[model samples]
Every structure is written in structure tokens, then in C-alpha cells.
Target: MIKVIIFDLDNTLYNEKEYVISGFKAVALFLAREKSLDYCTVYSSLLESFVINERGKNFNYLCNKLNIDKSIIRRLVDVYREHYPEISLKEDIEMFLLELSRKYKLCLLTNGWLLPQKMKVESLRLDRYFDTIYYSQQDGLDLAKPHPKYFMKILQFYKIEASEALMIGDDPVADIQGAKDLNIPYFQISNELDDNEKQKIMQFLHNNI
Candidate 1:
């Protein structure tokens, strides 16, 4: 009797790697232009830096490696965070969401900064499909996933019991364990978006609901 479906937006609905690559390209282009370096070289450097350094400190690593002024790192960081990303759901996902919306109330729950997450939803036109959306930063409760209260707030809002809701997501801790903490059902998958995964979800809904 799953009446509601909660989706983790980033790696669940769409491939988060795509968003990261888009941001990298933006940063690469900016660096190439400013430093008179080849765009491809800058892009490769940024990618390598991303893998080795903490995400927030990637710009510092890039600046140190490229001998670029540290002052400009702030601007680069802003570009990486604020750049408009090219993102969209796959055809299978679009159709699945359309079908799911008809049968179950769908809510998007994600952890991230408020504005950027909203922008991602807007860019992909996902805002229309969800009944309600929750962002960790915007919820005013400072609640983050893996915390029971985070899921509790949503249940309270919809007036639904934990047994009546299902969470589908890619993160074990943030999405799956959080729901499990309350005896809610959940399905976890690898953070890649693929037709096989979408089909599995559709099948799960059919069998379980």
C-alpha cells in the first residue's frame, strides 16, 4: 500500500556525473581563456584535480598546479557552482515519472544547497512532476538525510505512515538507511541512470504496489 514515492534527485533521477562534467567544462573554458592554455589541457587538469582533491578545494589545487593567481580561484569556484548545466531526464525516465505520477504521489528529497538544487530541477523541467520537493538546506530545519527527522518531516507533511511510503534512491546512507530507520520500504541502485534500472523500478512498483 505504497501511496507515496520519494525520489532522490541527483543520482537517482538523473546521472550526477553529467552535472559534474558540465561544471568541469565550464570551469575548463574559463580557465583556458584566462590563462591562455589549451581548453583540452585545462579540462584534463581539472578532471584530474577533481579526482585527487576534496571537491571544495579543487580550485585551489588547480590554481596551484597551473600557477594561476589564487585570487581568481574564487571566481572559478563561483562559475563551477553557478553555471547553467545542460541536463535532462532520459526518455524511459520521463515516461516512468509520467506513469508514476498518475498512480502515486511523488516527492523529491535531496541534500544540497537550496538555489543550485532548485536550478537543476528547473533546468530539467522536473519541478512540475513532483507533488512536493525538499532540499536539506531550504527545509529550515537543518535536517539532512540519514537523520530520522528528515524523513519524519515529509511523512508529517503528507500525513502518511512510514509503511505507506517508498524511497527510491542511489545512496545507501542518505536515502535507503534513512527510510529503513523508520521501517519504510526503499530500493537502492548504483548511481548510474540506465534503461535496465528504470525497468527494474517500474517492475518493482507493479509488483509491490
Candidate 2:
């Protein structure tokens, strides 16, 4: 039985589309006003650079290299924090979580800056739902997800075996594969995969996982 279910925050818990629309609009507006750069160019280039670097939402590094003022990124992040609380939860998530809480402990294991994620939790009123929340930055740990140490740390901290836990999220490689690496089973919750890829993932999850 899965005693604990570890969840990812952004794009996993809430609707990814809402975050994209709000986050992009804020970034574009901030760039146009402060940097005098083309709104589209800055937004496009920032996303491209972020994808290339594989550092999702780590804007401090991007700010230092882009010659753009860190203030702009910080400002947008603040806007996101303010607006993100208004973001609605996905279908059945609220009810599903309520149902799950009665059976098993719910824990959140996410990697992000302190303010935005904290604001998100507050805005969504998620504190009452989870037994615990483990944030990479807030905890003063560099152990982000996809790193085996991150999963190991949670397991050790909770005093639960890998088999007793289930990691659920939308990201396949990061959350699914990462959990698998540490003998913790995972379930994919989004429909972002093609049929073939989905089948492969299905087998991977059950076979020796």
C-alpha cells in the first residue's frame, strides 16, 4: 500500500495553462517596460535559453547572464505570486485529494524559490491537505527532484521505505524516472504523451518498479 504520495507543485498540482498565460504575460510586460527590448524577442529568447539550460524557473542565473536587470525577473515572479493564488485547481483534484487524505498521508516535494511557491500554497489553501511539504530551496537543500539524493532525503526524513511511497506528477523524466531510480514507484497523471510513449511508460512503471 502507498502510505505517502509525494507531489510536485507547479504544472503538476495546478493547471499548467493558467501558469503559462499569466507568467508569460507578466514577463513580456516587464521586459518591454524595463529593458526596452522587444517583448516577443525577450520572451522567446528567455524560454529558449531556459530549455537549453534545463533549469526551469531558475531566473537568477538567467538574469545574471542575460544582461537584463534581475529586478525585472524578480518583479514578474512577484506578479506571478500575487496572481498564482487565483489559479484554480484541476478536475477532481480537490475531491481526489480529500479522498486520498483519509487513506494515506499526502506530502509535497517540490523544487522552486521560496516566495512564489509559498504564496501558491497559501493562495490555494493547500496547507490543510498535506501532512508535510518539503521544498528544496526553503529547506536549505540543493537536492532538487530528479536527483536520487532528493528522493533519498525525503525517504529518510519520513522514515518510510521507497515501496511505501508513490510519486505522482506530470513530468515523466524528472518525476517518474527520478522516483524509479530510488526504488520509489511513480504514476503519471497527465495526458501529455503519445500512445506509444504512454504504453512504454505503463510497462516501465509496473515492471520491476
Candidate 3:
């Protein structure tokens, strides 16, 4: 029986792109005021850099593209990552979590910087729903999901067998593969679910999980 439900924190629980867009807007405004750049241009350029390079490289990419000094990259990246994002759990997902928590031990396993991920949890007011939470940066370097040790750590800490846990996440490689590596069954969330799909999943949880 699945006694514990482990969730991925980013796109799984809440839309992570909301956090990215919030950061981009903040950075755009900051550059426009502090550096005398055009707000629209700065915002659009940052968005493009984000899309092209994804996360870590965006700052350098933007700076290089705009001929901005390398020194500014750190500040921009810090602003992006450290900003308090406006995010929340969808009402339906919130209800699902509430219902699930009543029956199963709910925990979160995520891979990211500590403060930012924690801030996301706080912003969504989701801290109360989770029995335990783990972050990659909480321990040592490179101890994130996709690593078997990370999955094993959670199981060991909770004293639950792989078969007794169900992992639900959006990432195929990180969440699904990590769970599979340890022989734990998993559910992949690809997109937003409608009411009927939610009901079907709930039925599956009730009947089989």
C-alpha cells in the first residue's frame, strides 16, 4: 500500500514559470531605473535570454548581449533568484492535497536552492500541508533529484519501502527516472488536469494506491 506521497515542488505543485516571469519583470524594472535602459527593451531581452539559455546562463547571456558589464550579472541573477514570487496553488489542486493528506503521509522532495524554494512554499502557504520537505542544497553539493541517493535518503528517513511510496512529479527525467531507479512507482503530471481527470486520479488513488 502507498502510505506516503512524495511531491515535486516546482512545476508540480505550482507553476514555476510564474516565478520566472515575476523575476524577469523585477529585473527589467530595476535595470530601467538604475541603469537608464529602456524598460520594454530590457524586459523583452531578458525574456529572450531566459527562453534561449534557460536558467543559470541567462544573466551572462543578457549581459553579453547588451554589452553590460560582467559585474552586473551577479546582482541580476541574485534579484531573479531571491525575489519573493507571487504564486499560489490552484484551488482544485489545493483541495486534492487536503483530501490526500488526510489519508497519506505527504512530503516534498525538490531540487533547488534552499531559500528560494522555501520562499515559494511560504508564498503558497503550503508549508502546513507537508509532513516533511527536502531540498538539494540542504545537504551537500549535487544531492538533488535524479540522484538515487536523494530518493533513498527520503525513504530511509521516513522508514518506508519503495513500494510503500508513490512519487508524483512533472519532470520525466528527474522525478520519474529517479523513482524508477529505486523501483518506486510514480505518476507523471504533464499538464493541467480538468475536473474529470482529477476525479479519475482520485479514484485510482482510492482503488489501487
Candidate 4:
């Protein structure tokens, strides 16, 4: 039976795109105030760059476009990473988590820079739902997702075998593969948990646990 439910933070619990857009807005506002640039223009440029390249150098694109010093790119990155993200969980999520928390030991295992990940967790107030939270970077990037170290750590902490835990996440390679490598049962989920997705998860739980 499944006694532990491990969740990925970025795309599993909340919409990660919302966090990205929120970070971009924060950086854009900072640039506007510091460089006296147009806020909308800067925001649009950042969004366009992100859309085109996904996770490419968005700040570099903005710096090149605005003829700003490349040295300031570091500051822009810091602004984006350290910004208090304006993000929210889906309307159904609070109830879902509340319900799950009663039945299973909910833990969060997310891979990202420590500061930004912690900020995201704080913004979403995930501590209320999760019994334990593991930031992969806290251990080291080398032991991040797809390595299975953190997954093993979570299991060890809960004093449960891998079979007693279920890994729920969006990333096929990072989240799913990590759990797989650890011989843990896992459920692949979408970035947004719609009604159908929620039903599917419930069915998976019914079948597995």
C-alpha cells in the first residue's frame, strides 16, 4: 500500500509557467525602474524571448536589445530568481492536497536552485500540506532529480520502502526516471491538474494502493 506520496513542485502542484511569467514581470519592473526603460516593452521582450527559446538566455536578449552592459545580466538574473513570485495553486488543489494529506504522508521533492525553489514553496504555502520538503539543490546539483539520491533520501526519512511511496510529477526524465531508478512506483502527471487528470490520479491510486 502507498503510505507516502511525493510531489514535484514546479509543474505538479502549481502551474510553473505562472511562476516564470511572474519572475519575468519582476525582472521587467526592476529593469524599468533602474534603466528607465518602458515596462511593457521590457516585459514583452522577455516574454517573447522565453516563448521563442523556452529556457534560453532571456536576459541576454533583453540586454542586447537595450544595449545594456552584459555585466548587468547577473543582476537581472538575481532579480528574476529572488523575486517574490506572484503565483497561485489551482482552485481544486487545496482541497485535493487536504484530502490526500489525511490519507498519505505527503512529501515534496523538487529540483531547482535552492533560493528560488524555497521562494516558490513559500509563495504557494506548500508546507501546510507536505509533511516534509526536499530541495535537491540543498544536497547538491549532482544529486538532483534523475539521480535517485533524493528519492532514496525521502524514502529513508519516512522509513518506508520505495514500493510504499508514489512519485507524482510532470517531468518524464527528471521526475519519472528518478523514481523508476529507485524502484519506486510513480504517476506521470500534467503541469495543470484538471478534473480528468485528478480522476486519473484517483484511479491510479485505487489500482495501485
Candidate 1 error regions (>4 Å): 32-38, 51-57, 139-142
The candidate scoring highest on TM-score is 4
- Tens-place lDDT per residue, model 3, 1-209, is 78888888888877788888888988888889889988888888878987888877777777887888989888887887788888888998898889888998888888888888888888888876888888877876576788888788879988989988888888898889999999987888875444665676677677765
lDDT of each candidate versus the true structure: 0.83, 0.68, 0.83, 0.89
The sequence of per-residue lDDT tens digits that candidate 1 reaches over residues 4-104 is 99999998889887888788899888877877878887788778987877367777777787787799878987887888888888887888888889999
Task: TM-score for candidate 1, please give it.
Answer: 0.86
Clashes of 2: 0
Error of 1 at 150 (Å): 3.2
TM-score of each: 0.86, 0.64, 0.85, 0.95
List ranges where model 4 is wrong by over 4 Å. Answer: none
lDDT for each residue of candidate 4 in 64-87, tens digit (9 for 90 to 100): 887888999888889988999999
- The candidate scoring highest on lDDT is 4
Candidate 2 C-alpha lDDT tens digits along 78-106:
66555554566654667666766776788
User: Which pairs of residues collide in model 3?
Assistant: none
Rank the models by TM-score, top first.
4, 1, 3, 2
Model 1 Cα shift for residue 156 (angstroms): 2.0
